[model samples]
Target: MASPLSALLLLALLALPAARDAAQDRVDDGGGYEDEEGEAVEEGEGVLPSPGQRQGSCPSSCTCSPDGAVECAGAGLDSFPASLPADTQLLSLQNNQIEVVPIAALKRVPLLRTLNLQNNLITSAGLPADGFMVLKELQYLYLANNKLTQTPGSLPASLVSADLAANFLTAISPGTFGGKPDLRSVYLHNNRLTNAGIPRDAFLGSDAVETLILSSNSLTRAPLGLPPALQRLHLRNNKLHSLSGGAFDQLRDLRELYLQHNQLNDRSVDAKTFTHSRRLEYLDLSSNNLTLVPRGLPARLVILHLERNAIAALDSQGLGRLRSLEYLLVHSNRVRAHAVGAAAFRNLRRLHTLHLYSNELNRVPRSLPAHIKVLMLLHNTIHEIRAQDFAATPELAELNLSFNRLSTKRLHPRAFTRLSKLASLDLTGNQLTHVPVGLPASLEVLRIQQNHVAVLGNGALSGLPALRELMLSDNALASKTIAPNIWAQLPSLTTLDLSSNALTVVPSSLPASLEYLYLQNNRINSIPEGAFSTTPNIKGIFLRYNRLPPHVKDMFMGLEELQVLDLTGNFDGTPEPGADDGEGGDGEGGDGDEEEGMGNPQKELPQRRRAVERGTSVPRPQKT
Candidate 1:
């Protein structure tokens, strides 16, 4: 082997050729870049000339492309530039003070394909009847965030996309998009449109319109005469309280529909509405005042969102018809058990996810489809869970019953025996006295905190072989009530929480796989040596607010891999009654007999034993 200095020099020499080649491959043109028109534009060093860079011989404060594209955005020009390149294909004069668009002045760049005059003071009264018709090649036009009072007309026949959103346009007159065979998308959202303002034939002139966005308007009813090729429609954030039965009968190709944040009520929807939209797949009717699901929805729908509605009932005739539906969300409603009969959802065979949270149901809904994998029932008044509550849904993988009034006695002994595939179960914030048994062996996470569970019986965790996290905090358990081998059967246990209990010492039989142990706010008074010998992999141990013995360092000697050990709030160390007599002791304080036997005649008062306080670092023990 070469010496260290010689090896370092050899590596540097091997990288010299490759580094030089990489540096030589780069070229610099004095920070000048070519534009759309094949002309050079000067920018700063190491910066690419984009739409913000000014070019030579172009208008002041404007960027010109080599292929004849110009951007004069935020230039403060009162009107169109007088000296633009005659062959410019794209012109962006947005964020200016131009009050009018002079087509005669723009006749120079007749080949322009895109024009962006957004965020200007342009008004409809300032333009001629055939204003934009002069640019026959215009394809994409944007006039959003302007002061236009009316929709522009006589647009170029080749136009494909138009955006007039956030304008003052109150109505869409006939022939607004007429004869434009290539116009496929139109945005009229954030306007003052209403039912009477939109003519019946507003979109009759265009047969190729595929996407229409009319949200945040004043419309109270659905728009009519939508093109047959329309696929997506957004009418959210409006006052559409009712929809005519024939409102959507003409849309044969509609697929996605959004009508959320409207004032629609139960009587606002017609019976025959949406019956003709055979290809519809997604529907959102949230934030409405409806009392029930609207009738006549297409059978091919996949996701139905009715969250935040006031619907009170779910009958078989209303939901059973949706054979292909997969997701049904009716949370934040007033639904009751009697309102949803037993067979209300029996026909929804393919349903996989059902959310009925924040409802008025007294118990878990019955007749849930067998394919349900996730069930959410948080924040309800449910007080009990029976063995058959989850018998119908054996494939359940996640069940959330938190924030309820559940009791231990009300929970049947065999309540969770059928959930063989369940992985996560949350019973937090309830009134229980013990860890419910009969849990599946495949459970991985069990949370039962914020309860009155006083003790964990011996067989409470016997069946949970694959358990990894066990949270039993905020209970009234003590070392006497807990079995000595409570944690012995949990071979895969990693995180154990026993804080805020009445423990007197560190429980024994801890598994080797344990990593995090929480025992804070307990009555533990002693930690003997070899207490944690089986748990060498432990990393964090919280013992705050405990009455620990004087020799705390000996208590942590077995924790070789410890990282964070909290021993705060402990004031003094005094042996509990009979603790020093080689007999059972509560370990809370020293007995009077042992302390008096020491007598008060000792010479230096036997140096006071200082406890292991906060921030005391322990050296990691050497591994064997």
Candidate 2:
């Protein structure tokens, strides 16, 4: 026998998972916009009903609970239901075809605190004048995803949160939100709001309004005279071109601000624009046209996103005061090696992650932060790695240098010796002919795919006992040049990818703990008996698009845990006269051809195997 207030709280808690799902969909489909309506729904508090509750009458089309909660959602009603519950406190009518809000019907439930009319066809003209002024005890009003051209002229004074997103609103009168002292959150995103449509004092008496979302609008400039108690403001995906000085001087409690995907530049922004927001923590200015980093950022900032800009240089003065910064993303810019000052990042002692990929840098930036952990420099023009390049950052764990011009001759022998804690390294799409020496013994994942690597000499990967994953696809590897027992040194190896190579046969002496082996798109013609004898724990073996002959099922005799054996696109003991050599051209040795033969058997094998019997079936190979 719980109280009616407790039951209403339980119902609100049950709706949170659906709200989170909707929020995630908005974030993914709306181009990285924050979902403020979801937060408003979570923080809404309903009013308590008076004592001596009554079991009110229920409508035939709605489900009524003894706690004064009624649910009539998604009932396909073209008009509002005629409810006669006098003590009802919560009513949900979302996902319906109702076109009007009957003022006479709502006047019956004077104790209503929460009214949800989302996803309806209600228009502005259909709402009667002073429709919501009767429910003086209402606190939460949700009218999102409607056909309203304007907000309701009058609202209750006890309203705590209102959601008007995804509407056709174009203007807001000065008194629309005035005289509401308890109002805190208002959502107006994905609307047609313009700069001139909003008056200067639109939020005049809403002194407690903290979160305001005006993103996805047509505003040319940020709104002036915002509430002083604002904490989070979202203005992304707008047409803003400039910001005047003292624009945000009143919002002293602001913490998170989003201004991405706008038309801002260096000349249009003042240096002291954000100097008043001393407690700001997260700022996103990505996808703009600025050529240099903005100056005069707050000192207590923690995360800054400046990616997808036209920035070309970094000076010590631009980022000298952000000592509390932890994450910095400047990728997809025009930054070069010489343009970066020597002490540009020396002051950021707490920086942990730095992303400089897709730039014009020819070398690593000088004076990197000492405590950095993750560094991404892929898709650059860097050709060499000096010995003392990583001496300043000893705590590095992950480094990605893929899609660069790094060659074996230009890379120093002791280039990565100082990175004792390095665990993951990606050298994909390079020109290295052999494995680099002096790799850290603590490495775990190594990706050298799409390179010109031809040989794996002895002692190349000897000391790496903690290595687990190794990717060598799209290379010039052949069975004769690979050193014997080269993979036995890695005792903890689990996955090995060698697809799209020039190997004529399966490499021997694999690790005993190997679980997944990918050897597709090769020139292998026969499988030697006991080819996988040492690796008894192997679960998946991919030999698709190869010149494998029939009667190779004996290779999987003792593998008790064998789950997947893909042998599609291989010769079925009757070779065609003019058939091309396997998916990756002849096994002689150049960069292998990258054709889409059989389409990544690892991902499609499970479904294809169940549809039709295309490959030979081993004795105990379970279908996965």
Candidate 3:
């Protein structure tokens, strides 16, 4: 039952792995090598000469296709394989014990365009002094997850993308990537690189480099002299404490910048640091030491993640310029209601989701964007909700105010009357003694659990025709206080949870569309036959930990769709006559066969059938 805001954040974090895998797949597959005629040659279609049979044959331990692609990964070789095809265009030697990449072996594949040497034991001293300069046609090189203590100097000028991640590199030499005009991506993350280890002009000549990932390093400040063409930069999980004014002065085309999990503070970032990045669309600065929302954000930003900071206020200077912003996550901060300026979010016309949960606010912030659809303000100290709290946001669909100090008396009578499109409302863990009045008719799910509610007035649920799920568990409701026809107003009601209440017998007149009923942990002793006759489509009934006596099987005789019936922790005594010889009658407390059936009822039916063979009487519902 995760909230929508939490689920969206999880999806964003999981996208990193998918992106990495896609990049690796492009390097591994080589997009199908070309033949001599420049025609596309699909892999596994052309078989080359057998290994160890000729001078230009494939290595004995590798597989070669007619398109000049060789794969020798995980071959357990101590050195580079010999006798590679002279026209090899793609070579994969990853996941091997090869420590040295002899230059002579690469001379055979002078046309190699993609070379993968990742996940090996290759060290700096083991590589050639001039790097892979002999492979003149190389375009993609993957040397990640190796033992290199320094960058491989003088990479081929034709290199387009290089992956050097998860290495022991301590420094990047000046000319490591200087002259490659076609170099577009460079991954140097998960290394021991420091600010001083990189030269000011380390990437001076690589003007085409668009992506630079230097995350998981020991950088205390932004690197200098970044390429002007850089479009995406990932510097997360570093020790960066500040961004000097000129750090991003040259990156005009930057679109996505990730600086999360750093030590950046309000003063550490200059106001003009991002002034030149006008095209920036995605920015993530979460898990930092920021005490205020950074100013001078790009107006074109679509997603901004500033959660898990120490920010205490929101002003027009920090948020007024972002008009295209759609998702704003500022939760887990110290934002207060009074500290928020009146025009803080006045210009964000396209914003749809705003998450300010776990803050210090005592009331909803005024001037919320009108078009926002989801607002999560849970885990706050707000005690009252006024009538105009959400007057401007009529398009809001889901609202969560759980884990607050809100009481029915302090809440205005028409607090939520304006939210005509609100579909789900969660007010759990509150101090309300009764359900809030004037709920919108469009509400489909209402959860007010863990409260002190003891009564449901006659019209408490009158107009909610679209309500599907109502969870009121952990309350003080009693069977006598519940109106018998109260559920008739909700025609679409399917799931109702009334467990952990003070009901003596099952409530009657349940909605006919009810599918699941949870009345466990009550004081009920009898069902009064046909208690569930109206709910013909009910599938699961949980009445455990009650005072029901033995031989209650007759109560569920006509429930054709009943799939699970959990009667555990009840009927605690010796078995009645003609009952099975077991710990309790009707498999009440034995081995939890009935209890475990709550998830998969079909798996527990055989055990019950065996009990019936031992002189026990169990009701078996027939499926149509």
Candidate 4:
């Protein structure tokens, strides 16, 4: 029933008798221990020091905690500190300048469980053959981000994880990790490993290995003899071009396989390469040379990324086995409308995301999964959006059709009527002359920039009660064609872009919730006193490259929340005296005669005033 401290005190008392007996025996031996100076040293004095004087050794900048842990990171140290505490269990020397790990450097710290030497200049030659044999209890070791050309030897058998990534290791020799039965994770990515340099059974000794990361290597063929318990394998950014029979037959527990950015093709992949990877959930085969979807995909796959390939079509058989697939990314391929089968995704009821952007499709793809929530077809040749093109996905939330050949005449009136839950629609860089109508009420963002929409009609965006961002920049919208109450219905609108247009005056009747307003690169000559009076929430306004008028009073009135006001390149006019006093005067006192506009626009105020009074302001005629 004794507490830990009480029992330790009792043991100390018991050891005192034995200590006295040892001292008596030493006295009976005719002489006690002698020092180098022939002085007879008293028994238990400095030789067997008291607990208070038994301090352990540590580097000047390092902290040795009570639990035998030492940390000396970022010290610019060029070598391991001499005389480390023998009981030290954890040592962190990360971010140092130490170039070599000398043999016997850690021989005294036999209890070390974790050793961190990341971000150093360690090389294979710096580590002796049996350099780490002294650390019998080491469980975790990190040598990543070093200059090693080969794996360090003599790793403790108790090691659980070893991180050797970001090094110059060219190959993994046989028995490199031999006898490490408890090894669970190995990170060798970002190295120069090649298939010819690695022995066939390099991983045969690591029977318990679960995660192997070989990404960013030069391996032209898949490594052999993978542990059966492997769950995750990363071979991305490699030269792997093929998979042989039974390549993954033993990896039944594999859940994630990353083969992206390789030279893989149908001819290089075994027809049954993934036959045993039934539990795999994520498969990445993007950026390859495959002309068709590789067959024998697991039915439990949750995500398949095959973008940037030579696959020219969506073959029904290619997707027939992935019934549980939730995401299919095939963008940047050669897929054309005619190459896709009518039932390409017929069995993918759980599919929620599909990416077909940057392809050769000339029409809206059909027969997409019904539960799709995100659809990307941007950078394609699709010239039209006909009715029911996306009718199957009523729950679509994000659709990116930007950078296509879409024109006003090719859009069906009810093209997006079925997508009631749609939240974002991108139509930038298209040929549309006007904003499409019937946008879902739940929409939050609309991008239609770089188009020819000369006019924004009333009710063009009436149904989008939740719209918050509207981008209409780089268009041909003129102030005369934009309705005075164009944004009155967008109560939730927070951002509006009308830059690079033909606007001669700021659009009036902006929404009260407007926050960011971009009107740069336009012909706008004036901002009326009440122009921003109702938009109290306005935060930023861009008015550069415009023909701003002369002296004006209360031009920024009611814009108390505005943070950005861009008036660059505008006509410079003497502030009517008392301009800050909310009154217009015929004064000359000002900050100075600032230069702006194509010429002195102050002389044209009378014309601008008349134009404003008539509820229309045409851009001034340009001189030939």
State each model's CA lDDT, in order: 0.74, 0.79, 0.80, 0.76
Q: Which pairs of residues collide in model 2?
A: none
Model 2 lowest lDDT segment of ten? 35-44
Badly placed stretches (over 4 Å) of model 3 are 1-98, 108-111, 503-508, 519-528, 531-624
**Residue range 1-624, candidate 2, lDDT tens digits:** 988656765676457335533643474367432222110001112233363355346877887777678788887766776654777878888788777777766776778888888778878876765778878988888877777778888888898877877778898866557678999988887778998888878888888998888888899888998888898888888888887668789999999888888899997567788979999999888988888888988898999999999999988777888999999999999999899888889899999999999999998888888999999999999999999889888999999999999999988989888899999999999999888888888899999999998888888888899999999999999988888889888899999999999988887888888999999998888876667888989988888789876456446555777767776677654533212332322312234333242222222333333222334443342233
What does the lDDT read for residue 423 in candidate 3? 98
Candidate 3 yields a Cα-based lDDT of 0.80
lDDT tens string, model 3, 460-518? 88899999999999999998888878988889999999999898889888899999899
* Full-model lDDT, candidate 2: 0.79
Candidate that scores best on lDDT: 3
What are the models' TM-scores? 0.69, 0.85, 0.79, 0.81
Error of 2 at 515 (Å): 2.3
Candidate 1 vs 2: which has more lDDT: 2
> What is the RMSD of candidate 4?
15.4
